[model samples]
Target: MQPDPRTNLNNELAQLLNNRIVEPDYKREITITFRVSSAEKTRLEQRCSGVVQSDYIRARLFDYPLPHPKLVIPEVNRQAIYELKKIGNNLNQQTRAINEAVKIGSQPLSSNVKEYLQTIKELAVLLEQTHASLSQPISDEE
Candidate 1:
């Protein structure tokens, strides 16, 4: 007995689809292929402007330009932390200045002080999180 057309279509649909693995190349040329309907392609293009069918297809298929990591020596991070600590005192002083300026109705000075204080707060939070992550102790429950 021959299988029904709908049954054959279901069997084909069940076939495993895997990506074509390739070597890592940030700027290397690549190709992509998909069996998308014309309507689907048009919808995608309309939603994301300046994206031609070919460009979208190529982007999906190939490795595109990716930035290389900036070289950061371990010592650089240490120096940065040290500098951050030194600047932390200045940030505190600026925060105080902001309060004084606000009292004097110096809106511009107050704004600058608020900006500096916010930056300092962000830096402090980041430093605290980094230190905590690095110095996590083993739990007694282990």
Candidate 2:
């Protein structure tokens, strides 16, 4: 007796559908379509920053907290950054001068230079603390 061709085709189609349909409560295996204005899309992208668009959208849809983006250095921080760069350059020059003096068997580091280096170190510590404070999370109470 020959098997029914219709039954075989139905079975194959059923298997295909079963494979494609995801069980509920599983990681997303379905696609959702939506549209947004260009301005809204841009804002969303900017807010998400380093996050993938899909993940960001999902977080919003599900009311999950969005991940924080890296902090932008404020104008005050920018000035601090410039000062740090200047300090670093001066330190480099002082180190080079000291090295040259050592090569010539002469003392190159003056007391004033040592004091300046100590001041620079202290300034660096303060800058680091400021940066840390800036990056810290603010509580809603505050």
Candidate 3:
């Protein structure tokens, strides 16, 4: 007995129908809700004229530019800091020289040495003041 051709044809047609392609849509799957005053709604609709409401809202929501933070160092402060560092290095070298001279008994404590030490202390105070001033937030008045 021969197999039925109609049955085979029916099976082929069913297979082809089952294998047909289906394209997907591009719509999002989530929904959001918010309350707005009637005036605000009117303003938004006016701004969104000639564009779809959802597109305008989505662009405003997701494509807006955010303000970035900034670090500003004033030129005066930079120059002052550089000068302070140089002065600090000079003070350190002078202290080391005095210490070495005292250790070797080459120089004795004298009025000139005391005056130099007083000047170094004054310079240290000035450096601290400059650093504190630079670290403070800049005021609008300045």
User: Number of the top candidate by lDDT?
Assistant: 3
Off by over 4 Å in 1: 1-80, 108-116, 131-142
Clashing pairs in model 3, backbone N/Cα/C closer than 3 A:
none
Best-first order by TM-score = 3, 2, 1
Which scores greater on lDDT, model 1 or model 2? Answer: 2
Each model's number of backbone clashes? 0, 0, 0
Q: Per-residue lDDT for 77-141 in model 1, tens only?
A: 66665666677667677668777777888756556666776887897787677655544443437
lDDT of 3 at 75: 86
Pick the winner on TM-score between candidates 1 and 3: 3
Across residues 1-142, which tens digit of lDDT does each residue of candidate 3 receive? 9989999999999997776443433677988989999999999878865466666776565553322223355888878878888988898789888878977889887889878878888988888888777866555577
Order of models, best lDDT first:
3, 2, 1
lDDT of 2 by residue, 11-118 (tens): 999998666642335566789888999999989888787677876776666555566555455677667767766776776677677668757879757787677667
lDDT of each: 0.61, 0.70, 0.74
When summed lDDT is taken over every stretch of 10 residues in candidate 1, the lowest stretch is 64-73
Q: Give residue 38's error in model 3 in angstroms.
A: 29
**Segments of candidate 2 deviating more than 4 angstroms:** 1-35, 38-68, 108-120, 127-142
Assess every candidate by TM-score.
Answer: 0.29, 0.41, 0.45
